[model samples]
Target: MELRDIDLNLLVVFNELLHQGRVSAAARTLGMSQPAVSNALSRLRKLLGDDVFLNTSKGMVPTPLSERLAEPIAFALGTIHDTLNSKAEFDPATSARNFTVAMTDIGEISFLPALMKRLSEVAPGVTLSTVRNTAVNLREEMENARTDLAIGFLPDLQTGFFQRRLFSQRYVCLFRKGHPLAEQGITLKSFCAAEHVAIVAAGTGHGMVDESIQRAGITRKVRLQVPHFVAVGHILQTTDLIAVVPEAYAKRTLEPFDLETAVCPVKIPQIVINMLWHGRHHREPGNQWLRQTVFEEFSS
Candidate 1:
């Protein structure tokens, strides 16, 4: 392929199409008409001398050639985007930039309110949109810029991602204020006998608490399994189910309801919370400012 034959704009369209996987969706993302995007794809195919993409029942599937080109094209685009952005100063107070954050529900409860209040005072024009973080796809999402940052207990991020430890939290058991377990402090025997509610954030019934219990050679009865920490309050308040959650989350829920928290009977390891971003955004001024803001606010 001749350098003169390549239109850089066509590569941008190709990258968007690769990410979106559908012509209409790519058009919306690129702010181009469907025909324009299709035309660009045609031009790219002709220039590259391969049918770069194929329309399938599932979506637009990239051919082997397209798959090979994806990384280099994306890297080049990212470099260009970051270079162009680096030239401009990022004044958060005046800039109307939207950032997408990926976090778990627990993270939302722990950080969103304080972060928003600080943002309102310091960066009135800035906006934040949050998406749930699933460790499975976090690396892909960040690399593609689908999420600017992910805040949670993500210990499995790949080598290419940059992560800053935000905080460390230990498990605390929460129960109704008047529950029998609350009267006398939690003990291994009582904790083992009580019916518990387990938070299965990773869709696995067993978590750190379970591991700790097993290590102590104690078998605790899990009467219920919940997907989120936010539901712990209502479940504990109305039912006799006790839940072991992060200390920060336990404290947050206790004030609103007649709930009490105590140290977990079984010793679970502290969870390390981190703010993760792709290396692609590591040097971008806007991302740097945001990362610094988060580090200053939450790193404890």
Candidate 2:
């Protein structure tokens, strides 16, 4: 490939094409028309003296040259983007910057309200957007600067990521304060005998709550199952069921749901929640501020 002849703008288009594998998809993502993307590809081909991609029944298949060029082009683009975003100083009060966070529904319910409240006091112009932690490739997105940070029990983010400990808490049995089980407190017999509402907090490592309970040779008769923890507070309040939830999460559920919690008779490992970001963003002033704000607000 003729590296000196490559137009930086067309390289952006080429990278999108390689990722999406279709001209229309790349065009839509880049906010350009299909013909514009096709033209860019043509320009890239002319510079290289070979077709970078070929239209096949499957899609636009990359030529050997394009495949070879993908990595370095992506690295160059990512470096440029990161350098620009890494301001020497950040003034959140006046800067109209936006950040995207990847988190589970539980984080939305427990953390967002307080975080937004604080941001309102300090950085009213800054905005936040959240995507489901499991819905996308989080590591890739963060590395590319498409996502700013992630928060939760995401064990999969171990490699190539930096994390700050928020807190760790054990599972507790939670139910309405007025429930019959509240009178006796939670004993192993009462906990197992009671009907329960189970939370299937998919992809956030929250399923550990249930798995640990089962491993303890104890099982609650789960009468209902919900996909997220946003509803756990509501369900527990309105029913006679109990749920095992992280102690920190249970604290948030108390007043709004009029709930009470007791130590889980089944001892389970504590869950450690963290705020995670890619190393590419480690030195950015805004990223630093955001991490500090979150750690101060939520960490124990």
Candidate 3:
């Protein structure tokens, strides 16, 4: 393929078509007419020497070459978009931008208030929305720019994504402050024998904590399982069942409800929380501002 012969804009259209998976939908997304998109696709196919896409009942299925180029092209286009978008100077005081983030309920509990407070003081018009986190397809969601950022411990992350260590904290065993185990720190044997309130949801790594315990030849009987940390309090308050949770959230939300946490009796790895983004926005001015703001806010 001769670099001078290929229409560069057609590559952008190709990317959009691959992403949207339909010519008409891609046209709508790019704000171009369907014929125009089709024309761009034809040009792109001719230049690349591939069918690129096959129209099927399911939708546009990309050829192997198109599938292979999808990620790199998307990343490259995203970088160009961020670069061009930032050519206009940012005035945070007057600029109103909506940033949608994906975070766990506990992250919202720990960081949203401070983040909003800072935004109100510095950039009042800026808005924020936090989406629920799920186990499956999160990487794909981020890659497609559906979620601007994700905050948590994502294990085995892929290349072409950026991650920054936000903070790390040990897991704490939470129970009512005056509960029996709270008086004396739980022993490994006692902890393994006690009833637990586990958090179970689709696509969570926390399930591994249970697996690790079993691998150690110890078993902690789980009496109840809850989806979110906030719900753990309600269950802990009424029963002797203990819940293992992140120390930061435990310190913030559980204490008021007469809950207290102690170092876990068994050896568990410290949880390292990180903020993640697609490399496309690494140098974006506004994204840099937001990232630094979050880092400063959380570090304090």
Candidate 4:
């Protein structure tokens, strides 16, 4: 495994394989022949003394060693590309940059409308895509450079990531307008008696609201459990089920729909929503612009 004897070009082929998942596909992406890419992969495997990738029924899968190396290699490539094609400054008025952000449905529903309005006027050429938040693995995604920014409540972010508190919010119960509960303010006893739609995620049956209710020696029955808060709004529109949602999202998402908010029968602690990013781009101009734009948008 002499460093001097190893072909540096093999790493590029290896990275392309990891990105494209097949030798033929990787060759097409790298603008090289399939046999040449396969030869490079074989030489790389021998030089490293490990099978970096293995072919399976589905396709080529990266070995654990290769999986561990993927982030560093991808970051190195990105940095090299950025350095070679560096822009002196990012001009929002003229530049056409597409940004990919990861956020939950609630974040999209709450922020996208206003954010888009601002972006249309200021950065008309810019575009955005929202990645679904299936799990709370935001730190890993951000550190790997797979996402530009993650907008959510990541309570267990790693140390290398930075966070800026966008705003603080709390949970409030939402129900259809002119419901039975509208006559009187919701009480703990009456809240438990009503059917509820639980916003469950990450295999947890209860949310922060349920925890607060438990602390008060009350157990609210959760009749329906769904993954996204946007679904909660839809259900509330047609059903008698009540849902506890983030106060900010509840206000924005329920505006068009016929819904009313009632003070949570049980006191729930407020949620501090923050924007998270890896320190790798902590000083980069484009990332700085995005962070500032999002902060200003949310603040206003």
Per-candidate local distance difference test: 0.87, 0.89, 0.81, 0.82
Off by over 4 Å in 1: 1-86, 203-206
What digit string (tens of lDDT, one per residue) describes model 3 on residues 1-300?
576886778988988888799999999998999999998988888888899999999999999999999998899889988997867556679879887787887888888988999999999988887886684466777777777787777775659888888998777788886788887678887787779998875455466667667777887798887777768777888888898787888888565688887888666678788888888768767777788888988862
- Pull out the clashing pairs in model 1: none
TM-scores, in order shown? 0.70, 0.71, 0.68, 0.68
Model 4 lDDT tens row, 133-237: 556466677788778887777766659988899988878899988778878768877798999998875522236666787789987678898876767877888
Off by over 4 Å in 4: 1-87, 203-206
Q: Which whole-number lDDT from 0 to 100 does residue 179 have in model 3?
A: 85
Per-model clash counts, in order, read 0, 0, 0, 0
- Candidate ranking under lDDT, highest first, comes to 2, 1, 4, 3
Give per-residue CA lDDT, model 2, range 174-292, as digits (tens).
Answer: 99989998888888898889999888877877787788888887767989998878788888888899988888789998999999999888878888899999998899999999999
Estimate the overall C-alpha local distance difference test score of candidate 3.
0.81
Highest-scoring model, lDDT? 2
Runs with alpha carbons beyond 4 Å of true place in candidate 3:
1-86
